[model samples]
Target: MSRDRQRLLDYLVHILEAIARIERYVDDLDEVGFLTDELTQDAVIRNLEIIGEASNNIDKYYPEFSAQHDHVPFASAYEMRNALAHGYFRVDLEVVWKTLEKDLPELGLSVDKLIRQLMDENSGL
Candidate 1:
């Protein structure tokens, strides 16, 4: 992998780790509702933004990757991240909760697949 791809992968790992942490704290409606506080929500949203930014960078470096993975929802992920980063004041906790419960897991799995692909390619596997 190129240096840029490595960096992006690092960021992707960070995003995954952050998501795992948030997931540990939230397993049901009560936990999710309780974590609606600004600090906790902001941390989760920020990690998502980091994930989106890393994915965007990967797309720029490897357009073929983007082409092969068009269904990954990269643009929507970035847009949601942008909203969280720039419009935190207006961010809806329910939306964040829904995304964490739905989108993040799928995104994490996709990212892991991409990372594995990159590694296998680099290793000539």
Candidate 2:
């Protein structure tokens, strides 16, 4: 495998790990519970930053891959990361909760699928 492909895989793995961490952090919490818990909110936001950083790295280092996998929301991930990391004062818990409930699962699945596809293509499986 090329070094770039390996790096891409690494970024994908990072995103998956972040997604899992976010899921675990919010396990049984409802929106209200998540809103009330500063610790969990911080944890979730940190993982989200990780996801955004990884996505940004992938988009930067592998434009072709990012272009091909248009469904993965690579741009959105990084944009959200900027918002969460740099604009924390303006962060809305309700929007964050909605993203957690609706977007993360789909993003996780999309990333997982891309990782598997890359592995399969490389291994001839």
Candidate 3:
């Protein structure tokens, strides 16, 4: 694979894997019950940070590709990461949970589509 494509693919995989981990961590727990424990919350938050960082990396490294596929909220993820990383004490956990539960599924699908597009485009290059 080309270096550029590899970089993009790495970010995509990081996001998908992070989502998988988040799902696994919250697999049996509902939102109301899940936040009581700190371990799971911390794990999920770290994974979310990973996702946001990966999204930020993609935006910086491949702006054209990112702009072409704007359905995914890469900027929001980055902003979330910024908030979590920079404002750790002030983050709204409810918002994080809601976003993970709702927004992530659609984002995952979009990431998959972007990966496929990257693979198809890079295969010819």
Candidate 4:
């Protein structure tokens, strides 16, 4: 694998790990109840930051791959990451909750598919 591809794979691994952590943390909580706990909120936000960061790396290190997966929203993830990492008060917990509850599962699936695609490409090479 190219070094950039390997680094992209590393970032993807982090993204997947973060997604799994968020899943485990929020599996039992409802939306209203989810943001009420400080620990869960922090955990979720941190994982979100990780996802955004990974998305950014994928865009940077593997531009063609990122461009191919236009549905993944790499730019939006960077925007979200910037919000989470820089502007604490700007974060709408409800939005965060909604994202976790709705968007994350689909994101996970997309990212997993991306990993498989990369791996398949590497194997062929």
Say which prediction, candidate 1 or candidate 2, comes out ahead on TM-score: 2
Task: Report the backbone clash tally of model 4.
Answer: 0
The lDDT for every candidate, in the order shown, is 0.73, 0.94, 0.87, 0.88
Q: Candidate 3 lDDT, tens digit per residue, 23-52?
A: 889989898877786898889889999999
- Indicate the residue-level lDDT of 64 in model 1: 76
lDDT of 1 by residue, 1-125 (tens): 77876876676676667667767656543545645566666666777777777667656776776788897877787788788888847877778788887888998788778778778888999
lDDT of 2 by residue, 28-114 (tens): 999999999999999999999999999999999899889988988999999999999998678888899999999999999999999
| lDDT leaderboard ranking | 2, 4, 3, 1
Candidate 3, residue 18: the lDDT equals 93
Better of 1 and 3 by TM-score: 3
lDDT for each residue of candidate 4 in 1-125, tens digit (9 for 90 to 100): 99877888889888889999999999999987787888899888999999998899888878897888889987787788899989877779998988887888998998888888889999994
Give the CA lDDT, 0 to 100, for residue 90 in model 2. 86
The CA-based lDDT of model 4 is what? 0.88
Residue pairs in candidate 1 whose N, alpha carbon or C atoms collide under 3 angstroms: none
Model 2 per-residue lDDT at 69: 88
> Which model scores highest in lDDT?
2
